[model samples]
Target: MKEIWNLAISPQVLPLTLLLVPVALYWLLNLLGTLDLDFLDVDIDADGPDGGDSSGGHWFHGALRFVNATDVPLMFVLTVLVILLWACTMIGNVWFDASQSGLTGGLIMGVSLVASVVMTRYVVAPLKPFFRMLRADDEKHPPVVGRTGLVRTAWVDERTGQVEIEMQGAPLLLNAKVATGTLSLPKNTEVIVIAHDADTGIYIVRSISDSIPPQSL
Candidate 1:
């Protein structure tokens, strides 16, 4: 334990060790219920430019695309990466007496960073399906399809809207848009979900009356 502690605080790996502290704290906070971390699971734009476009103006977009490839929360990926880096540094320090100062130490640190990024990026892919399942439960499951909900937006058409449905004694709010050829629904109107798009988490809905107009009665 003493040897492990000494290596963790060594300058070669100190930065990753420092980052791990806060991540561990956040995990503890989550367990204590003081922090609800569901927001961290929200999806980002992964379809953005992969390598720059014609103008080379997609640097930020490209960065996001690369980071989002794992489909897991960025915090989770960072936590895994820091742990890996810390372990690598500890092993190197003990077995090889790796440098802890000067140019050699800087090079070691640089390599650790790049290696951690590449390792985490690929390591998290196989685990993405599991993370996505968790995300779905937190944000969009229990099969709200075919259920009735009220339009929460001023108007709901192919381009825009929202709906609120009662589920498990709480409100389940969802993004909603009418199917093609369906008329728009106004606020407070009743609608039923006809389909759900898992990729976008949007529900395709139609006015309740559209299925059974008053004239039919």
Candidate 2:
């Protein structure tokens, strides 16, 4: 235990070890109800390209693609990556006895960091289906019926999608579905927040056209 403790705080492994501290803190605060994940959400501009600061939006968009963060919780992906990184760095340091921070230590840390990203992808892949089942509830969402929002997913249909609504406060990203008999709404397609399904907490939306009109809850 003492040896492992010394290794964890060693120069090469220490950076990732320190990162795990905040990850633990975030989860602790969440469990205690002092904070929640949304407070830490990096709002991905999902409403196609014209949504927000183009550069910042593209950067996060790129990152999500790089990490394959879709259909799964973001922090879960981050947590897995952080833990994997720490393990890889620690193992590399221990195997090479490179804990004293030299060329070998730096190389171990760098290689581990790159390898961890690849490792994290495969590590999280099998867990995607499980995490997809754990959708966040929308009980606290304000009434958004009759409001308008932009489709934020590649497209929205009966089974899956998201939309960004510009309501009173900051824009709210709501899980959305298109009306039956309606074609899929593509990303950035303006649609009316027609109805809210209280039972399932999904919003039913329809494309803004001459045919369909605003709806109530």
Candidate 3:
């Protein structure tokens, strides 16, 4: 144990030892439950006629640009790798002497690098499509939109109400509502969705417009 400790604190292990800063910070923040530090904001606009960006500002439509992209996941991963490699090298140096330490450290580092690359490329990248698909489905058929059913309970003055909607050939419970207008539509009224509020996860609806008024009579 004394030899291993000495080896870990030696000049050969200086580079690896220097990498524990961000790793320690990450774990410390996680333990304190304050790790959600978002440098970007994602918002969906629903007020416009086309349900597009309502802000009309370039900043609102632009993609997230990180101030320091390398300060995030990459730094965290490298920090962990450095710490792991340092420990492995220390053990190798103590058990097999400094002569064999270099070779063993190189082998272990190479294997770890390859494993990290493989996991990132194959495992994480492939799961991205599945996550995208789930998001798309959720957006398309949000609990109250793109569904047809009867109102099971009455919606009185924005109070809570329930709707039984048929979704994907299955009945689903959904929150129901009446559009804010001059008049309030009653229960069991057939309606078509006009917009969706992402923050509230609410679907704004209007009575299906089916009319052919006399043209320039």
Candidate 4:
């Protein structure tokens, strides 16, 4: 335990260790109901350029996109990335017996950052899907095709996801999924119910962008 503690705070891995504290705090607060984290699970939007300084505004968008953060929340992506980087650095430091203030440590840090991003981009792919499910009480699902809905989870892919459909009363939450070939849809994406599977009880959906006429799901 002491050796592990010492390595965690060592200079080579200190930055990632520090970054993890806030992430841990966020999860704790979320579980305690002290924070509304749903809003934080939002995707990056580059609908149009922010005019003041086009490059300045666009740079942030590009960076996130480069990291493939279009389908997941920025915080979610960062949290996973920080953990991966921390792991990579710790392993590298132990393997190399790297000194905190030297070039070897810097190299390990650099490699960890790149490796973490690449690994994280792939790691999040599974979480990006839309899922199909039926309500526990109901045996036969109702027809909701052509209805409009908004993505409610972090992302919607071919396998699993959630969408909320507004009605006269409270909104309805549906088990949403995309067709096998369809790309994953990010949170808050307006979608149109495209199809449904009776056997599976999963609703298939597509983004409103695919059927754009006045822009709505």
Best candidate, TM-score: 2
Tell me the tens digit of each residue's lDDT in model 4 across 1-217. Answer: 8988899988777788998999999989988999887632243333334222244435665566566555456677788899999999889888886455568888889998999989998887665442112132332435578989898765667866668877665677776789899898877889999997765556899998888777476
Q: Show the colliding residue pairs in model 4.
A: 129-157, 130-157, 130-159, 130-160, 130-161, 131-159, 131-160, 131-161
Please report how far candidate 1 places residue 137 from its true position, in Å. 3.4
Measured against the true structure, the TM-scores of the candidates, in listed sequence, are 0.55, 0.62, 0.32, 0.55
Candidate 3 vs. true structure, TM-score: 0.32
Each model's lDDT comes to 0.68, 0.74, 0.46, 0.72
Pairwise lDDT winner, candidates 1 and 3: 1
| Stretches > 4 Å off in candidate 3 | 33-80, 95-217
Model 4 segments beyond 4 Å from truth?
A: 39-53, 56-59, 130-217
True-vs-predicted CA distance for residue 177, candidate 2, Å: 11
Better of 3 and 4 by TM-score: 4
lDDT of 1 by residue, 1-217 (tens): 9978877787766777887889899999988999887743343321224421222323433443355542567777767778877776667666555545545656666776777767777777777777656656777448888899898655566844668877887877776789987777766889888998877556899988888956553
Give me the runs in candidate 2 sitting further than 4 Å from their true place. 37-42, 46-56, 97-99, 136-148, 151-162, 165-172, 175-217
Per-residue lDDT of 101-210 in model 3, one digit per residue for the tens?
A: 56665665565555544443333333334433443455444345654555443331242334556667666544445556524344565655445555444455545532
Cα lDDT over the full model 3: 0.46
